[model samples]
Target: MPVTAVDTDTDDLTMTLVGDFPAPAGRLWRAFTDPRQLERFWGPPGWPATFTQFDFTVGGRARYEMTSPHGEKSRGAWEFLRIDPENGFEVLDGFVDEEGNLTDELPTMRMTFAFTDTAEGSRLTNTTYFESAEALEQVVAMGAVEGSTMALDQLTAVLSDLRAYAEGKGTRTELISDQHVRITRLIDGPRELVWRAHTEPELMRQWMLGPDGWRMTVCEMDASPGGRYRFAWAPEEGVAGEPFGFDGETLLAERPRRMVTTEHMTDTDYPSTTNDLSLYEEDGATLITTLIEYPDKETRDAVLATGMTDGMEASYARMERVLLG
Candidate 1:
């Protein structure tokens, strides 16, 4: 995937993706709309995806999984913000934890994809928005630009595949599918106290899950790389509710501020996925930086079909009340 640089340094690194996929407009359109067809060829280099559920409509929701070669899996989702008939669509995306919960500690983005017809091919343009340019830059530094291109290139291949399968396609068209998770709690607490409230599990449990039926089942601290421990969460009630359970193994753990883990769920037949959570505390608040690393950029993308962004926002709204109380 060739990533062309865009010069708008709004947050960290923000870019408007412009490219030409030399396929029919409908073919490209379907590649962006249909989930089943998307699973066929909807990722960067090595990651492959499986769509769990996809609903493409205003305020509709969807979910998907991207599995790495190492048997690792990353999940993502989106909420349809706006959908134009044949021009473009916008959505929010994020990493969803097991038990069907999107973490409050992650950020989400609004991504708009527009298509235009050209003589040789179809023009595809992507615009992404964040609360701040720094937020955009952090993720870009973590590898957003390349990831976007990889997904686009995957779309190109999927469209070509649609052309070939047009015998199966009847016509030349296929379908595909595919948050700012920022914590804005102008809480009234000193920096150290707020930091403690986040780092300490007791305080975390009080605010993290709110009064809902969500609770941490088990939490162990080795606090170092190669450390073995598990962090499990489940709903308080709704026995048949989301996230039957998810277990994470320690990968990187930095005391007083950061931790990284390899997360796997008890249900959902998928492999382990990596999650990096960093804590940045200042005079009166803390900024948690979470990086969910996939086998590659593509898988982080495939699961992005689900609407995890809004979930995070709602969950954090719940978190704020608990934290303030």
Candidate 2:
């Protein structure tokens, strides 16, 4: 997703800026609510921000300062008026002195943020109501519009990194034998969520790709004994690799506990294999273990030589993020 242009609307008493983010509302909400994440993208480029105080709740107060490379600092504060997680919030924003006190000489505005769900992702509509027309003019003349646009552009990058970090965590693989490969990971979420991520097609697609620019274009599952499933991936444009696809039949599906399937790589020279996936809760985390058994030693060696284990590790890391999110 790209950083969209900020739309501005001005009148006698208010200045409204609207923008869209190609991320889920829940993720965007966390960025706004979490101070560590907020400070990373709160200021324009080249002016890093530091949060001195952040209490993200109704009637709470927040204080921060943005410093330029030349050592110039601009302080600000927010008195939160209302907060609705993943939806919207309202705050009284104003300039503060270096001592963390609101400055009387600067203008103050009431800002409301509304998050709407869209097909593309989330739409953030920010409306700032000034005390007077002169107040609006003063802030605009001080580069409020330009500064906000740049800050939100920074937010786009921060959100991307957040997603990547969530999708790139602890994952490992081991070659137990020529006919078996074992992959293990400790996911940082509940076992139920992890189980759903494995069984549901909607959740499966989010993290089941081989590599970047590749997507699971097809995902179908029947979580019952004797049921079948199919998954296929389409490579990015201009990529030379052939499409990858597979079909499997479920031999066991114990919700939130274990699953067993016989899988066949379609349109390939490989033979069918059996996959045993089991999950358990350990110390408030879920431990996922997958064991793949090949038809022969040669077939397992050939698949391993193709570097499929690395891709599987990447995909599992992505699955961790999906479960966390």
lDDT of 2 by residue, 48-102 (tens): 5678899887999999988652346899999999988789899999999978788
lDDT of each: 0.58, 0.77
Highest lDDT scorer: 2
Q: Candidate 1 lDDT (Cα, whole model)?
A: 0.58
lDDT of 1 by residue, 1-325 (tens): 3233444557543467787877766677787788866764455433456678788989987787765533467777888999997888988876687644676665677878888888987787777777676677666776666665665555543565322322121111112221111112223334455555545666655655523566767655444566565555677666445554556666544354445667676656666666555443433434443445555445555544543443444444555456654
Q: Which runs in model 2 stand beyond 4 Å of their true positions?
A: 1-12, 162-325
Task: Please count the clashing residue pairs in each candidate, in the order shown.
Answer: 29, 0
Pairs that collide in candidate 2 are: none
Could you tell me how far off, in angstroms, the CA of residue 175 lies in candidate 2 after the best superposition? 46
RMSD of each: 19.5, 18.6
On a 0 to 100 scale, what is the lDDT of residue 314 in model 2?
A: 78
